[model samples]
Structures are given as structure tokens and as C-alpha cells.
Target: MQLPWMSRTDRRHWKSARTTAALGELMAQWLEGSISSRPGYTPRYGPEDETRPLVPTLAALCRAGYVTTCSQPGLVGWGADDAWWEQRAAVEGVVTDPVLLHRLVDAATTAGLLVRTIDYSRNAPGEAPIPVTTRNCETAGEFGGRISEADMAAQWRGLNPDLHDEVSHGTYVIILAPEYGPTGNRLWRILAGSVQEVGHAA
Candidate 1:
């Protein structure tokens, strides 16, 4: 459903509207107590410095200013697990050459991030991490004739077959944006707990 507060044009023009909407629905469900956090995990949204506890409401998320209500035009740099990386590889438009991509990942690692990527060389380390980036998805049917799912899968597998299972369903890439600052311990922690699936509500 379209958010009640959004202008018609805003809904029409937002590139990541669907993703935001989907997340909103999930957040709404959580806020209404329809879903609950699982043990050993406390879910928080919005900016890290905000002291107010998350109230499970969009207003609260908005108020805290971490879980963006609207998609920002620039990259919202974030770290994520293999699932997110896989999803990004399958669909996002930002394609990087393997060698160059590895260099960036190496830089991030040097700066202190435990990122995970597909290892391109057998002699290289087994767990090289891929840096994710934010980019648009291709228009519907744009590549229909050009690339088949099997072909895309093959290409993604080439990026790292061992990573297939983890990133197969995610939707965004993990590239570091200058605007978001360098990947480090803070970003790592955020990624680690950013999305937690709790058990069903009691």
C-alpha cells in the first residue's frame, strides 16, 4: 500500500519506493506487536546516538532518523551479510570488474571490516569479502532478451560460487560510498544487528 503521507508525485518518482514500502509494512507489523524480537536480539532502528528506545512505530523510526522513511538519492552506505551481497549481484545495475572490486575490498579490510566476497583466485585467501554498492535495478523487461536468469546466475556464480547460498535473496550491493564514510567497526556492528528476525508474536 502507498503510504498515506506521501504525495502522489513522491510515490511516482521515488526509485526505491517499493523497497521502502515493503520495509514500512514490516516495521508497521512489528510496531503493532504482531511480531516480536527473538531472544538475545534487541532490534533498534534510526541513528545510533538517539537515546529514545525504538517504539515499533514508523513515527518512532522517523523520529530516531535511522530507518529512513524515504530513500535518499545518494548511497546509504552499509555493511551486510552474504545474503544481501548475493541479491545485489543478481539484480543491481552497478557492475564492477572482478580485479577492481577485489582491490576495493582489500582497502576496506585494511581499514578494518570483516566483509565477505567471492574469492576469484585459488591461491588467494579463501574468504575474500566483496564490497557492496547501492545502485538502481534495471527497468522491467529491459534486459529480457539480452540476459536470461540462468545466464545471470552463471555470471553471479562466477563472482563466487561458494557464496551462492548466502546472497541468493538479498536486494542491494555492498560498495563503500565516500559520503557514508569508511567501513570500520561501527559499520560492522550495524550490519551485524541491522536486521534480526524474531519469533512470532505471542
Candidate 2:
């Protein structure tokens, strides 16, 4: 039986789960020294003080099913169990590797887990769309001038259909832009959201 608050379609529940997971992961890292407390230390996200107690966050994580209290002294720290590790692993699995990350993104997009925008365009008068630059643009415009105007316009259209009417192009180019997390903590949140969504759906 599904709890009224546990519906898969409930955005609030999803957000809560994600936030809990992120907090758990962050606390775990802090305890493990993956993040440090030195004056010059900057966490993966930014400079932040670490002296604050994590008990409240741990309580939240416990309520969200991403953590549990352990009596073992060695395991008393923030991320001391399988639940937290599994959630962190899922997020790391998707984000650390480029290929896997793309696959995960594709899955999320297909599942409607997130909103994706694609931009596409054709090559100029003489060439096939510059596959290299086109693909680069899909990620970011690092190789600036290498991308043709048509390809850029096509890619913009593919990413945003509203732009299709604005660009009358030669070939189809597409870049998928997804609004997901880039930070480890944020990534964990996304993974937690995915897990909660799946569990609730089941």
C-alpha cells in the first residue's frame, strides 16, 4: 500500500527525498574527510564552515530512509550504512563517467524525470554538419568558430522547438540541455529523486 505522501507523482515528496539524500552524502563526505575543515579548505561546492552539527540532517535522512542510527561506535558517523552508500553510489555511478552520465541523462529524459532541450542545425553551403563541433556544442561551445551558423541554428532548434520557426536550416543538429545537478551533492539529490520516483511508482 502506498502512503498518500509517497505518491510517485508528488513533486514535494521527490524534492524532500532528494534533499535528504544530498544532506546525507554531504555529511558523510565531511565525516570521511572527503571534505575538510581547514581554514583554507573549500568544499566541492564552495567555501563553507563545517563546524555545524549534523544530527538534525542525519535525523532528516533517517526519516527519508536514506540513513539509520547505528550503535557500533565505528559506524556512528553520518554516512555509516548501506542505504547512504547505495544512494551515493548511484549518484556517483551516473556522474563520474561521461559515457554513463550521458546514458543516465538519456534514460531520465526518456522517463520524463527531467526537462530536456535540444538544439540542432545544418552545415554551411559546402559541408556536412561538422560532426565534431556539432557534438561539442551539444555539451558546450568550447570549439567556437568550428561550428557553422546553420549547424548552430539547427542545434538551437533541436534543443528548443520554439527556435525551429526562427531558423530555416540545411541539416538537422541537436544538443540536449538538461537542468540536472553538476555538484556531487546535487547529483545525489537527483539520484534520490530517481529512486523515490521508481519506488513510489512500483
Candidate 3:
């Protein structure tokens, strides 16, 4: 069946304690082909008329410890936001700290996931500096220390050159988890050491 499109305002249902519990319960049943529904609430799957393709399940992914920074109630937007990220880290054991990003990268590599690292800090400025930010660095001097002044200028945009003034200076450590065959739709990103879905940019 075609699942109804949930409006942004309607997604608040997923954040409630009761709804989260219900969804978790539903997931367990869905896996067993025993899914049921409560009054006025139902779970959705992909189009019933379409053949469901075989793909690696989330259980298998977690069994292999291949955690993405994505989490339940995962909507189109809000990837990498504090709430979604906290849920991923807390519930799914996703690695979120940039300090521990290398560990996650190593784990992904060990799990045979495709991985790439770009140390923007050590690289020359491209047409645009990677869009990463931290709340720590307060001045141009601090920003300059992490990246060249020319790259810093690249970060500036819009009518106001200081549009990004509030963002402090920091070198970005980006890890790209590009599309792989098994995970199907999942694509990951580790920006400034924090794990999130690459879909955040979408």
C-alpha cells in the first residue's frame, strides 16, 4: 500500500514516549510478519504493489556494528540536528563525538564499508571550503590557524560577508560513507567528527 505522506506538523507523533514504544513494538512484529495496528494508528511499509527487494536488514547491520548516525523518526530533514543525533547515539550506539570519529572510521573499514577521509585542515582551499562549523572559535585569527585566509574568505557568502560570523573557527574532519550495495538507502557523513547522515544536505 502507498503510505500516506506525513506532514511536517504531524511528525510530532514520533517524538512522544508512547509512540516511540509503539513503533518499536510494531517493528518487532513487522519483522515477524505479524504486524497489527491499534485504533487510528498504523505502520507503513513501501508500496505493496511493488516487489520488495531483498536488502541487508537493520538487525544485520547492527549485528555487524555498522551504525549510522541516523535514527528512528528519521524524517527528510533534521538530519544531524541535536535531537536526532542524540537519539542515534543513545539508542543505536552510533558514534557521535568527533574525538572518536577515527574509531568509528576504523570500525567501518573493519566492517568492510566503503570509507573516505578528507582532512580539510591540511588540504588546499577548493572553490568552496567544506561547510563545517563549531561554536568555539571566535575570531579570524582562530579561523586562520585551522585554514588559510583565502579559504576563510571562501566560507564567507551572501550580502553580508560575515554571514557565518557566529560560527567559530575550526578545521573540518570529514568522513564520507558513500553509497554501497548492501545498505541500500543509507549514506553517512562524519562532519567535524560528528556522525550524521549525508542526507542532511538533501
Candidate 4:
């Protein structure tokens, strides 16, 4: 189903809380299947999946002729793959704080310390190419850190979230930036150390 994002014009029916909620719910379900599957998706279920977890909803959606994957293909500068259903996700949403979304997702799903990057390296008709943002980093030299350390901490307590958290779990975690080089790395590192430190302090 095509998401009627927060567009200024047009009374898009997808704006309803029900649609978004249902979609997010479906995404959660798909993630459950993806964890034991592949990095780019849950479409091709594996032995680790919950036995055709998304088949029902997906089949119904397909029968109804809803645009499932964004196969519209991204612009050249975007550097995204453009093969139908090649690089697809069950669903995607816009957010101001992608890191927070990632953490919240980790807390919401029992996928067992899961993690996934949101570069959306697919044929994104809408949410393509990802964005870049200035993150506040805490350096020993002082005058660092854009987002608060506390806010950046991982919700899942662990000795090392980056280690315990398996990226193979599924499609979760969305970094506003296109690459993990700095922002994504910082989030993972920060959350990992913060969680470890708190665990030790306790």
C-alpha cells in the first residue's frame, strides 16, 4: 500500500492512524521472519522464520493490487539498485529521529537484540537515498555530542549490543544518513558502551 506521507496537499487516506499502525504491525511481523533470513528482507522466508509469517497479509495485499514494493527506481545520484522486488522491504516510514526509531523498534520486537541499517538500498519511490545529518558526538576534547548521551543509550541492556544485537535479525534500525561510517557507527558504539557501563555500575 502506498503511504500518504505528511503531504501538505491532498487528503490522503493513508494518513489515518489505522493504516500506519497496521502497516507498522505488518512490518513487525515481517521482521520476525527476516531475522533468521537475509539482511535486505523477509520476503524469502527461511528455516529461522515463523513459518510464512507474512504470507497472509502479503497475499491479501497483493490480491487487492496494492503497490507493495517501491519499484519506481531512485535517481542516478541516489545510487540505489533498481530491480523490481530485488531490494525490497515489507514497509518503511519517515522519522525525524531514525536512531530513536531503531531503539524503540528493538524494544518493541522480541527479535532478540536485533539491528538493521536503513539506507534503503532499493528502488524507493518515496523514501529513497536517505539523508545526512549533523550528529552531536562526545569527544574527550570537549564541545562534542549533538544528541544527548542518555537519549542515545540503548534500551536493551547488554554487555555489547553491537555484538549481542544481530543485524541478521531483520529489517530494523533506520539511520537518517545514507551510510553507517559515522552516524550509524556512533549510535551503535554509543548504545553498546552506554549499556555496558550502566550494567557495570549496577
lDDT (C-alpha) at residue 56 in model 1? 35
CA lDDT for candidate 4:
0.27
lDDT of 2 by residue, 25-101 (tens): 53344444443321112222322232123333333333333322110111111232322111111110102223323
TM-score of every candidate? 0.22, 0.19, 0.24, 0.21
Tell me the spans in candidate 2 whose CA falls farther than 4 Å from its real position: 1-34, 37-96, 115-202
- Tens-place lDDT per residue, model 3, 1-202, is 1223433322333222132223333333333344322112243332122112211243222222232211221112223443211111011222223544465566456544444333443454433322112222211111112445554443322112231232113223222223212232232322212222322332
Off by over 4 Å in 3: 1-98, 125-202
> Candidate 3: worst 10 consecutive residues by lDDT?
84-93
Clashes of 4: 4
Candidate 3 has a TM-score of 0.24
lDDT of 4 by residue, 84-199 (tens): 11111122222223334444345324332223333322322323233222123211111111212232232111113342122112233331212323222233233334324433
- Tell me the spans in candidate 1 whose CA falls farther than 4 Å from its real position: 15-103, 117-202
Q: Which scores higher on lDDT, 1 or 4?
A: 1
Residue-level lDDT of model 1, residues 111-190, one tens digit each, is: 55433342222223333332333333322111102223464354333222333322233222232222222322243323
Better model by lDDT: candidate 2 vs candidate 4: 2
